[model samples]
Target: MYLLTLSESKPPNIVFIVADDLGWNDVGYHNPEIKTPNIDKLAREGVILNQSYVQPLCSPSRSSFMSGYYPFRTGLQHLVIISFQPVCLPLNISTLPQELKKLGYATHMIGKWHLGFCKWECTPTYRGFDSFFGYYNADEDYYNHSLSRVPFKGYFLDYRDDRQPVRDQDGVYSTHAFTKRAESVISQHDTSKPLFLYLPYQAVHEPIEVPKQYENMYPNIQSEGRRKFSGMVSALDEGIGNVTAALKQKGIYDDTIILFTADNGGWVSYYGNNYPLRGGKFTIYEGGTRGAAFIRGTGITGNRTYDELIHAVDWLPTLVSAAGGSVTGRDGQDLWKSISTGSGENRTEFIYNIDDDFPPVEGHAGIRYYFFIFFIIPMLPVLMGDYKLIEGYPGLFPDWYKPDTEMSSLDDPVEEFMAREGYKADNGYQLFNIKEDPTEHNDLSTKNPEIVAKLKARLEYYRKTFYVKPNFPILPDFAADPTKFNNTWSPGWC
Candidate 1:
C-alpha cells in the first residue's frame, strides 16, 4: 500500500475531498452535459471507482468515513445530526484525523462538519483537527453562512474560523472560502509534516445558490434548479482545481493523494440527477449508496476503473496505513495496496448501512417517509459478493430521477416529478444483483431465495449483536434553540 512512497521514505500528503449529496451521474465523466472538466480530467487520469459505496444519508456516510464504522455501530444510523441534535461521532472512537495526527500528520478540516456539534468536545478542533475552518451544520446559506429552515423564524449563523463563529464570512461563498483556506494550508504548511486536509465541500447540497457567472456557464440547462445545481458542482470543481494548483505550486502535488467522493446519492427533491440508477438519496438503492469516487495519488495507475467494492468506512484504515500508522479494531480494511497497485481483493463485501433507526418493519406498507409521512420502509442494505439485500425502507425517492432531461420544461419540478410517482418496491425485503444490474431495477429475491435469506440472516445477526438504536427523544431540544446563543448554531448548546 505504501509502495508508492515507501522507497522515497516520505509519507504522501492526503487530501480526502468529499462532495455533499452529489448524484452518481452528476459528474462530467458520468454525464457529458455537466461540464466538470477538472473533475473529468481527474477521473480520466485517476483510478475511477466504478463500484464505490457509501451510506445513503449525509451524517451516516460521513460517520462511516470519520469513525471507520457503520452508523448502526455508532448509533448515528438514524437521520442526520440535525442543527439541534445532541450528538457527535462518539468520542471514544479514534477518528481518521486523530489517527493520522497520532502519526505526525498535520491534520486540517474545512467545509461542512455535520457529524455532530452539541458540545465543544464534539467540534472539529476537539476531534483532532489541527485547524478547522467551517460550519457545524448543513444546508446553510451559500453566501451568508446561516441556516434557516423556517423563513421568518430567524437564521442560525454556523460558519466558524476554528471554534469562534466568523460573521465576516457572510458575503463569501463557501466553495471559494474553503478553497482559499485549503490553498493557504498547502502554501503555508511546514512541508516537514505530511498534511491531511479533509475538505468536505458544501456545494450541490441544498439552498442551491451560486454566483451568476457559474449559472451562466450552464445556460443550456433548462430547469432553473438543475442549472443552479450544475453551477454549484462547477464551483466546487473550480475549488478543487485551485486546491490542486496550490498543491503543485507548493511542490507536493506528485507526493499527494487526492481521494474525491460524494457523501451520498443526490437528493432528487433538490434537482439531483442519478440517471439510470434507480432511486435517489435516502435509499438503499445503488443510486443512493454507490458514489462517484476516484483516487489520483502518486502511485495509482491512471486511465483505469476499479470495479471492486470499496466502502466509505475503508478510508480511515486506508489513510492511517498510508500515513504510516496502525489502527486496531476498525471495520475498514487498508486499501492502500489495492489502490496503489490494483493487485489485491479490495473488500468483497460491505454493509451499505445497517440502520437500526426508524422505519418499522411494516416495510413499505404504511405511509411513505420524506413527504412528512411515517412510512414503514426497509432500512438496511448489505452487499456480499455482488448481491445486495435491503431489509426495510427501500428508499424515499424510489426511481431514477433525471431532472435535466425527464422534466426539463418545468421551472421548479420537484413536486410535479414526485407527483408523477415513479416506482417503489412491492415488498419490503428486496434483493438485487448489483454486479449485473447496477441500477437495482431487477429484484432477484424470488429467484435467488437462498441469497436473500442469507443476506437477511446477516442483517438479523447484525441487529442482535451490534445495532445501537437511533433513539432520539421524540421532541427537539428547545435548549438547542439558536436564540440562546445570539442566534447562531454554536457548540455548547446541549
Candidate 2:
C-alpha cells in the first residue's frame, strides 16, 4: 500500500456521515425505487464499496468504527447499550475524534451518540468531540425528542446541546434539525483549523415518522410501513444534500473528505430491505453484516467501485492516516491507498463476530481469513474461497415476514412462510460456491468432504485461540428502570 504524502498545505477537512439502519438497496444507486439523488451523486463522484461489512448491530459497529478495534477487543461485542447502562467505552482507549483533535482539528458531532451516556464522562463531548448536539440513546421519538423504551416512564427528553437538554427541540423532525445543526456548525467553523464533523443521522430506523410532504412523496408504495420508511430515507437524503451544499458554499467542499456509510444492515421488521441477501438484522448473514458504503472527496479517485473487503474497524485508522496522523496497535489497516487508488486488497483477515457464549448460536458469530470464512455458530458455514459449508440452518433462520403479506405483525413470519413454501434444510452439512451463487441456492458439501474437513479444523483452531470471554459484565435489565439506577456514575471495565 502506498503512503499518503501529507500535503504541505493545510490538512483536508473530514466529514463522516453515518446513516442508521440503511438497507443495501436503500439508495437510488442500488435500487431505482429509492430516490436518493444526493447519495447517488456521491456514487457518481466517488468510489462505492461493494463488500463493506459492519457489526450485525449499531452500537457494536459504532464502537468498532471509533476504536479501530474489534468489538470483542473493546468489550462491546454483544447487544446495544440500553439507556442508563453503566457500561461504556473504556476511558483509557483513544478514539478517532481524539486523534483528529490532536492534529489541531475542530471535532464536532451532530446527531446520534448511542455508544454510551450512563455518565457525563461517557458522552460525546467528553470522548473527543468539542461539541455534541443530539440524543444519547439507541433511539428516540423523531419529532417529540423522547425515548420509547417500555420500562422508562414519562417523556425522557433525549435531545441535548453539548451536555444540556434542549427541551424546546420537541416537535422538530430530528433529521431536519440535525441537518440544520450541521449547517450551523459548518458556517461557524474556524477555517484556520481543519474540521472533523461526524453526522450520524437517525433515519429509516424504527418508529418511522416523516414530514407530511415526505410521507406523500411515495404514493405507489402499498405498505404504509415501507412508505414511511422511504420517506425517512428521502428526508435523510435531502439533509445530506443540504450539508454538501453548505460545504460547497463555504468553499471547502473540494478540500473536504466525505465518507458515508450505514451503521449496519437494515432491520427488516422496520421496513428496511436487504434484498437478494438471506437474513436481516440480528443474524450473521450478509444482510446483517454487509452495508452500503462510499467515500468521496478531494483526494479520492472518482466514479469507481472498490470490491476489496473492508470492515467498520478500518475507518478509524484509514481516516487518521489520511489526516497525517499515526494509528498504532489497532486492528484496522490504513486502507487509504486501497480505497483511493484501487490498489490491491489491504485487509485479508476479518473476525466479524466473537460472542461471549461458547458454541455461539441463536446469537451468531464468525471470522474470515482472506476468502475463507468460518461461521462457528448455529450454522457452521465455512467459506473457503468460493465454496461455503453449512452444517445446519442458522438457529434464528427464515424470519420470512413479507411486506406484501404480514406487514402489520412486524414479527417473524419465516416459519409460516417456509412451511407454506415447502422449504426444508439440507439433512447434513451443506456447501455452495457463493461466487457463482450469491443467493446461496446450491449446496455441494457432500461432494466436497475434504474441503469441509479442512475448514472445520480451521474453525476449531480459531475457537480455541482467537475467541475469548467477553470482558465487560453484561448490564442487567434493571438498568433500564430509572428508579433502580438513576445516579450518573462511571462503572469499572474488566
Candidate 3:
C-alpha cells in the first residue's frame, strides 16, 4: 500500500550537515566559550535532542547514518585504513539518499567522505548519491586541498555528476568550499524537484586550520592549538550560516528539513571536549558517542527539546517517515513521532561497540607530537549505558590521557579480558545507571546486582546477534584489485 497522498503537495527538501570530531559542548548551545552564532541559531529555532548518539568513530558512524544499519552489520566494525585493505559496504543494502532518490530527490555530498578510501563499492555515487564533490581520504590538508597523489595533489576536489567525473577547481579550503558547493547545489535546484543536500564538513577535524578572520576571534584562548581549533570551529559555524542563508534565499526554508549533528564526539584531548560526559571519540563512553544534534523543518515546530535516546541509525527511517515514505527493514525506528508524543513503544536502549580489527594488527610509530601521533591507536570498545564492560586491554595505557607517550600497545589484547570470535572478552563488567549518572562516574556493578545481571545478559545476546561479521568491499567503479589501477589516482582521491 504505497501512498502517494502528498502528490498534491510539494515534497520537502532535506539538508543534513554533519561535522566531524565536533564535541557535544563545542557548539554555542552547549559550550559557552565557543562563538557559533549560526549553528546556535539552528538550535534555537529547531528542536535539540539532548540525547542523540552515533558510533564513536568516523567510518562506522558514517556507515550507520547513510545505510540505516548498525556499523557491525555492515562489516564496517573497524576503521578503513587497515593494511591497505578495502572494506566495502554491502551493495545490496539501500542507502537513505538512494531511497530518497527513488522518491525524486536530487542528492549531493560535499566535503569529507571517510566511508571508504579508494574502494569502488563504497563510493558515494555507487551508494546512491546523485552527485559528490569532496575528498576521498579520511583527512586531507585543509589548506593545500590536494590529495596525496600527484595527479590529485593536496587539492583534490572530486566533482561527480551521477558518477561521471566533472571538474572542480583547485585550491579551496574544505570548510568554506563545502558551504559554497552546498549553496550552489541548493540554488540550482528546480523548484519542482525536491533536493537532498548531504554536507559532511571536514572542519573541526584534524590538521586544524582556520581562516585568519575567525582565528582572530578566539584570541583569548591561551593554548595555540586550542585557539586554532576554536577558529576552525568558528569558520565551520560561519559556513553553516552561509548554507542556511542560501536555503532561505531560495525560498525553500519552510519546506525543507535540516539536520545538524556530529559524526562522533570531539577529540577532547585535542582541544575538543564533551565535558560533564566521560570518554571521547574512540571510546564508547557518553562523551565519545553523545553529541549535539537537532532537526528542524517541514513538520517540526520551534524550540522543542527531545530528551529521548536516538542514534544516527535512526535518522534514515525517521526522516523517511517524515517525508511520507515507507520505513523499511532497519534496526532504527522513526523517532520523530515518538519524541513528539512520548508514548511510542520503541526500544529504549542500544549498544555501542567498536570491535578489534579482526586479526589484531599493530599500528605505525609516527614521530608527530602527542596531538597528532597518539590518535592512530585503536581503543577498546566501551559499551555506553550498558554493563560497562572492558573488552580488550583493560588499563593497558593508564597514562593514555597524556599526549607524549612512546610508540606502544593499541595492539596487544589485555591478557585478563576474554577473546573469542562472537563472545565478550572474559573480563568482568562495570555497570552504570546512565539515567542517573551520564558520566559513568560511579560503577554500579557491585551495588545493583540485579541490573548488572540484566544488562550482561542483554550484552551477550547483542554480541551473538549483531557483531557476527563486518561488511567490507571496494566500490563498484574501482578495479577488481584497487592497487592494480595506476590510474586509481586518475579519479577522486587516489
Candidate 4:
C-alpha cells in the first residue's frame, strides 16, 4: 500500500502565482507586450502548457486549484465568496494543501481568499492551508481600501495571519502589501519542511488604481483604463521577478516547481485582449474560459509548448502526483508523468459551464450549486482528438441582466428553465474541431450532426447527473434536506 516509501527523493517545493483576471495574451511569452523578463525567463527555462485553463472568475478557480475538485464540487461555482456569505468548503473533500501537509509540507496562502467569507468551514485554515492573509471579498480598492462595487457601504482594510484579523494599515496598497507578506512568510517559514505557497492576487481586477511609481510605466498606452491595467500588470511582473529572485537567493529555485496562471480569460471590455478567441468573462466561449498556465523548476524544463486542453481541476491530481502522494481518489490524473515521461499526449475536449447558481441537491443550496453539478461535477478524461460537444444553448447569454443576478434569461422567458431539453439551434447544437478552430470562429453544427449527437449525449449525462434539481423559492435549508428541491419546481438557468 505504500506506493511511495518516503524515499530521499526531494519533493519539489511549490510556489503557485495566480494573477487576478489576467488576459490570455497578457504575458510576453504568449505575445510580447509590456516586457515580463522574469516570467519570460520562466518560459525560456520551463514548459508552457499552451492549453491550460481555469475558471472564468477568480474565486471558483482558486477553489478548484486548492481543492483539486471542480469548483462546483467544492460549491464555489460562479459566485465569489463574500464576507457575509459562508466561508465554507465541503468537508468531505480533501484539499491540495491538506495532501501536501500529510507529506510534511507547510502550506500557506497569501493574497486573495475570496472562496469563503464568514463560513466556519470555508476558512483557509480549515481547508488545509496552515496560514492565511488578505481579503475575503472578490475585489478591493488598491489605495483607498474602498469596496469595488458600491451599495455595500463603509469598507475598511483587514489583514490576517491565520483566520484571525490584524489591524489594518493606512496607505497600504493590497498588492504590494500581500507580496511583502508572502516574501516574509517564505523567508521565515521552517526551511526543513517542503512548502506550498498559494499566492492569488487582486491586481488588475477593477477600480483601476496603480501605485504612483507603477502608474507612470504605461504612458504610451492609449486608453486610461488600459494604461492603468498595464501598470498593474507591470507591477505584478516585478513582483514575480522579486519572488523568483528570493527563491534563487534561498537556494531552492531548482528544487521548487513554480506554476503561474490566470484564474480566467481577460475582460475584453477592460481593453484586455483574449486574441483569436470569441467572447469574454461569464460566457462559455473559449476566450472567457481558456487561460494561461505554465510550469517551471525541478523535473520540468525546456520551454516546450504543449497544445493539450487542460482545466483548473487538473491541478490537484497533478500536484499530488508530482509530490509522490496518493491521487487515486482524485478526479484528475497525475499530468506530471504524462508531460515529463512523454507517456501521455496533450489533452483534447473540454466543457465550459457558466450557469449562475448551484443546483439544489438534497435540498441544500451553496452559492455555486448550479455550477458544481453542471461543469465541475462531471468526469474529465482527455480525448484522442479535438472534437468537443457543448450542450445548453450555444452562443452568448446576453449580458442583459445585471451582474448580481444568479441566472441568465433564455429569450426573455417569463419563467426560468434550468434544463434546455429538446432545444435545437437553427444551426443545431454547435460543434467545433478545436484543433482547427481554437477560437471557435466557425460553427460546425450544421455540417457535423454526428459530432453533435456524441457531444449532446455527453452533455445530457452531465445535466441528468448534476442539474436535475433547481434553486429554492426561499433560501432553502442547504444543510437539512438538499434534495427536496428539484428543477421541475422552478429551475432557473439563464
Best by lDDT: 1
lDDT of model 3 at position 63? 80
Which digits, one per residue and each the tens of the lDDT, describe model 2 over residues 419-445?
454423323455556557655556566
Compare candidates 2 and 4 on TM-score and give the better one: 2
| Candidates ranked, most accurate by TM-score first | 1, 2, 3, 4
Q: Taking the tens digit of each residue's C-alpha lDDT, what string does model 3 give over 1-494? A: 11112233756788998999988768888877899999888887777888888877787788888888877677776544321334545668888898888778878888777666454567888788877887665655676653443222233433334445444444567788778888999889888888888899988887667778887998787677677878888999999999989999999887887899898877654566677777566656677777789877666655777776788889898877766686678877787666534446444666665354443211100000001122335743323343344334221111122111122223322232223222223345565566667776876667877766665566566667766455443333333232443322223333
Q: Provide TM-scores for the models.
A: 0.90, 0.86, 0.80, 0.80
| Model 2 TM-score (2 dp) | 0.86
* Residue-level lDDT for 410 in candidate 3: 31
lDDT of each: 0.79, 0.75, 0.66, 0.62
After superposition on all CA atoms, what RMSD does each candidate show versus the true structure?
7.2, 6.1, 10.0, 9.9
Quote the lDDT for 283 in model 2.
54
Candidate 3 at residue 101, lDDT? 81
Q: After superposition, how far is residue 151 of candidate 4 from its true place, in Å?
A: 6.1
TM-score winner, 1 or 4: 1
Please report how far candidate 4 places residue 247 from its true position, in Å. Answer: 0.8
lDDT for model 2: 0.75
Cα lDDT tens digits, model 1, 116-194, are 8889999899998999999888888889989764322787788888878898877888899999999999999988888
Q: List the residue pairs that clash in candidate 2.
A: 400-414, 431-444
lDDT (tens digit, per residue) of candidate 4 on 1-494: 00111224668789988888777777777767565778788866777778786666667677778776665444566445544333445567788898899998999988777765444465677788888876666666676544422222355444556755544555777778878887887788777888899988877676567886776876676566666777788888888887887787787776788888888776654545566666555445666677876877776645577655567878888887778776666435567766544457444434455243433111111111011122455665433346645544433321222112233224322123224422222223456666677777776767877756666666555545554221112332233221222201111111
| Over 4 Å off, model 3 | 1-8, 81-83, 117-119, 147-170, 340-346, 354-426, 470-494
Model 1 stretches astray by more than 4 angstroms: 1-7, 149-152, 360-385, 405-427
Deviation of model 1 at 42, angstroms: 1.7
